[model samples]
Target chain A: GAGVSQSPSNKVTEKGKDVELRCDPISGHTALYWYRQSLGQGLEFLIYFQGNSAPDKSGLPSDRFSAERTGGSVSTLTIQRTQQEDSAVYLCASSLAQLAGGNEQYFGPGTRLTVT
Target chain B: AQSVTQLDSQVPVFEEAPVELRCNYSSSVSVYLFWYVQYPNQGLQLLLKYLSGSTLVESINGFEAEFNKSQTSFHLRKPSVHISDTAEYFCAVTRNAGGTSYGKLTFGQGTILTVHP
Candidate 1:
């Protein structure tokens, strides 16, 4: 793909339900990241995937949040028992390299998740 | 761990006026700095970055940022602003320590720039 892409641009879910956000990174990009942005708040790191594995899952707020990548390509962020506080924009980013240093991330359009 | 601080939450200015958005960071080790801009209903785009070399870095959109190591700041500046410049700006940092860590950026609360006609 020319740029990172995300699906279901907008999603409205009820509290206690589950929601899944998806991201398709740039073709051949090796690194992928997920972030949550609340109203009037900064981007909060959630999880990151390198290839088909995730080495950095420390940012996930709780066990209700989980993510996985397959074939080192697309990724899905699943929030189980979604809470009202989970209403935020879910963003996905990709980078050419997997190293922590000396890399620039390309971001996707982001999925706006609204929990009612 | 690293953190980013964007002092201002919003900055309003007239078109053709100069603008500056301040950003600061705290980290024990060396880090890479970056600035990104997000237009309305869009994803963030890289504005500029300070990876190495001269402390000052520039973007083609007439925006520049200076990486001040001593102050741990990477303030973005534009000599003149335009209506098109109205957007949200974010500052981010990632530790430079070599390891399995992929660049997980720690971002600041964005500053929304509103340019008046």
Candidate 2:
């Protein structure tokens, strides 16, 4: 089975420009998450989507960051008016389901965004 | 809020030597623990997890972690390591929340393990 996949492995854009990163979760995965990894921040959760319920945007650092999951499969994370501080590796993960204890998350290669 | 702390930032060991990476977490409620490994230029992979039942969990690749509730720790250990074991290890935690969980993981500052031949 194919693991989670992300498009545009690398993206470089101007500081004020907007960028969208895409993610394709594994088949049958009902939960998807987005995280950011940077040299200073380590790894930080950005957002999560489960089934059709409203997405968990609690982890979004600021209002400029947003994400949407269409048809419960593919997810897109959009950053508006990106800043140099937003330059980081964006990783996508998916799990079979969100259980009480925990569910293993499969990760993608990640899209490295560089805000110039 | 939950937070994870990995004591060591880097561990350099000779091949075939025992290794231990310490991890401690702080949370007001029960949580699930996990160890993730990332080889250079690759995505993170699940190494092992401690959800429930046994306090000790083992991975297929000779790695094991023991969940210590009292100590609030889940440290990874291996009797012997190989050169291929060199990678960055991250310890993460998510709240149990009793029922259907939608919590995000709180990851530690990764520990880089460099196995020397």
Candidate 3:
């Protein structure tokens, strides 16, 4: 693909319902990341996937938040029993490879999740 | 863990004026620095980064940032501001350690730049 792409650009869900956000990283990119941008806050790292496996899930806020990547391509972020505080912009990014320190990540057009 | 700090939350300036957004980082080990910009209702775009080399880095859009290792700062600056420059700017850092790495980035609370005409 041209760049990282995310599905459901905008999603409004009621409290207590579950929601899923998806991301398709750039082709052949080996590293993928998830972040949450709350109103008036910085980008909060959620999880990082190295191909089909996730090695750094340290940033996941809680047990309700979980993510998985399949076939080293698409990723899904699931929020069980969504809460009002979950309203934020969900962002996805991918990098070519982690070497010699770091690689610049290309970002997706983020999904704006609104829980009421 | 590494952390970034953006001093000001919001900065309002008149068009054609110079601007500087301050950022500081903390890390126990060597790390790469970066500045990202987010436009209205858009995803963040990498403006510039300081992986290694000269302390100075630039963007095509006339914005520049300097990585000061001694001070642990990577401040973004521009000589002149335009209305189109209004956006949210973020400073980020990632570890340069050796290990099974996924390149997780730690970001600062963004600074919102408002350019007045």
Model 1, residue A1: what's the lDDT?
Answer: 38
Better model by DockQ: candidate 1 vs candidate 3: 1
Q: For model 1, what is the error of residue A11's alpha carbon versus the real structure, in angstroms, after optimal superposition?
A: 0.9
- How well does candidate 2 score on lDDT at residue A116? 98
What CA RMSD would you report for each candidate?
1.1, 1.0, 1.3
Clashing pairs in 2: none
Each candidate's chain B TM-score? 0.98, 0.97, 0.97
- How would you encode candidate 3's per-residue C-alpha lDDT over A1-116 as one tens digit per residue? 48999999999999999999999999999889999989766689999888888988998988999999999999999999999999999999998877654788999999999999
Residue range B1-117, candidate 3, lDDT tens digits: 888999999999999999999999999989989899999978899999998899999999999999988999999999999999999999999888766545788999999999999
Local accuracy of candidate 1 as per-residue lDDT tens digits, A13-100: 9999998899999998988999988886669899888898998899898999999999999999999999988888999999987555
* DockQ comparisons of all candidates to the true complex: 0.79, 0.72, 0.69
Best by TM-score: 2
Docking class of 1: medium
Off by over 4 Å in 2: none
Q: Could you tell me the lDDT of residue B85 within candidate 2?
A: 99
Per model, state how many residue pairs clash. Answer: 1, 0, 0
